[model samples]
Target: MKIAILGTGAGGRCHAAKLLELGHEVIVGTRDPDATLARTAPDHMGTPPYRDWLAAHPGATVCTFADAAAAADLVINGISGDHALNALTAIKDQLAGKTLIDYAVPYVYQHDSAHKWPTPWGFMPLLDPVDSDSLAEQIQRALPETRVVKSFVTQEQETVVDPKSIGGGDHTMFVSGDDEAAKGRAAQLLREYGWTDIVDLGPLVTARGLEMYAHFHSAVGLALGRRFGVKIV
Candidate 1:
């Protein structure tokens, strides 16, 4: 299957690399492919430039967000939380009648906060539309024709792609979406990525819980000082 990963961030790269290894044709989407490839330095997250990463994995194709989505059978939205809605909306025509697995948490960085939850790197980014609404739900509303499934937001991208790295791949992965078939597609991909335990949280609104868990996920990672996984059992 041809899969489009709509982002060039570390998370997107993780999915792209893993998908290529899984024998799927991968198309990576970005706002500007040229600018994404011209980067010589790492991103704020310190993930190396896209060009450097692409060099190691030449099988994946990089193009504009719309072009990638147009060519894909399925789409994984790795776009940053703040920009995903607008970015996906811009390519609405290409994504109609397709399953969109959104893993982005709507994080508004550098916001004013009376009580800051500082991390080893910086303060925890704020999640807008957090408790009552979620980025996944927002995207679903924005693109009425697209089937949106929320997954992969509960864990770091590394663990998401290679679940065996923690707990012998026994951890639980959750999927939430309005479309059953779309959620099934996401579960299939997770299984391909080596996830053995998956729970369907039922309906897109459950995405609020997944997105809101970001803070807790970060807190646990900081406390342990490592990458970890969570299991329902």
Candidate 2:
């Protein structure tokens, strides 16, 4: 499969690394592709670094956000939560008819009176706080023609990359989307990343629940002084 992953942070890098391992042609899109390459060498022997990873992937080469969306069989939005909407808005035109795998959490932090901390100690999950229409719903509305599947937001970056640390035996992933085919495709990619146990929560509306789950995960991690993760029983 020809895959394009936007953003080069830990989440993006992890997805790119796993995709490369699975023998899928992967394109990594970043704002400063050249600087990114200069900083980190390609971990995979055959993989190539690119301001435009599409070119190295062969049959597909990286261009602008619009180009990547238009050319790719699958487009993974691995950008940070704050930048997800803006990044996708930049290439909205090319997203029609494409399958978009959205992994984002809108979490705003506020000081917790109970903690008596100067800075915000608790996160305000935007899942319910952000009006009736959630972030995923907004994206779906913006690109009606595109099939959007939401997944991988409940867990931290580390857990997704190395499940073993969090009782890797049968880690679970929750996926929700309006399109069954799109959700199925996303599940296939999850399996490629070595996620064997997946829960299809059904429809894009279920994303709200998953986002709240992420907030809980974050809160628990903060309280425990550790990087918390989840697994399915």
TM-score to native of every candidate shown: 0.98, 0.77
Least accurate stretch of 10 residues (summed lDDT) in model 1? 116-125
Task: Write candidate 2's Cα lDDT for 178-206 as tens digits.
Answer: 99999999888877666778899988988
Model 1 C-alpha lDDT per residue in residues 1-233, reported as the tens digit of each score: 99999999988988999999999999999999999999999999898998999999999999999999999999999998999999999999999999999999999997999998887788888999888899999999999999999999999988899999998998999999999999999999999999989999999999999999998898888899999999886
Q: Root-mean-square deviation of each candidate, in angstroms?
A: 0.8, 5.7
- Model 2, TM vs. native: 0.77
Measured with C-alpha atoms, the lDDT of residue 209 in candidate 1 is 98
Model 1, position 183: C-alpha lDDT score:
95
Estimate the overall C-alpha local distance difference test score of candidate 1.
0.94
Residue ranges of candidate 2 with Cα displaced over 4 Å: 32-63, 108-131
Model 1 Cα RMSD, 1 decimal: 0.8
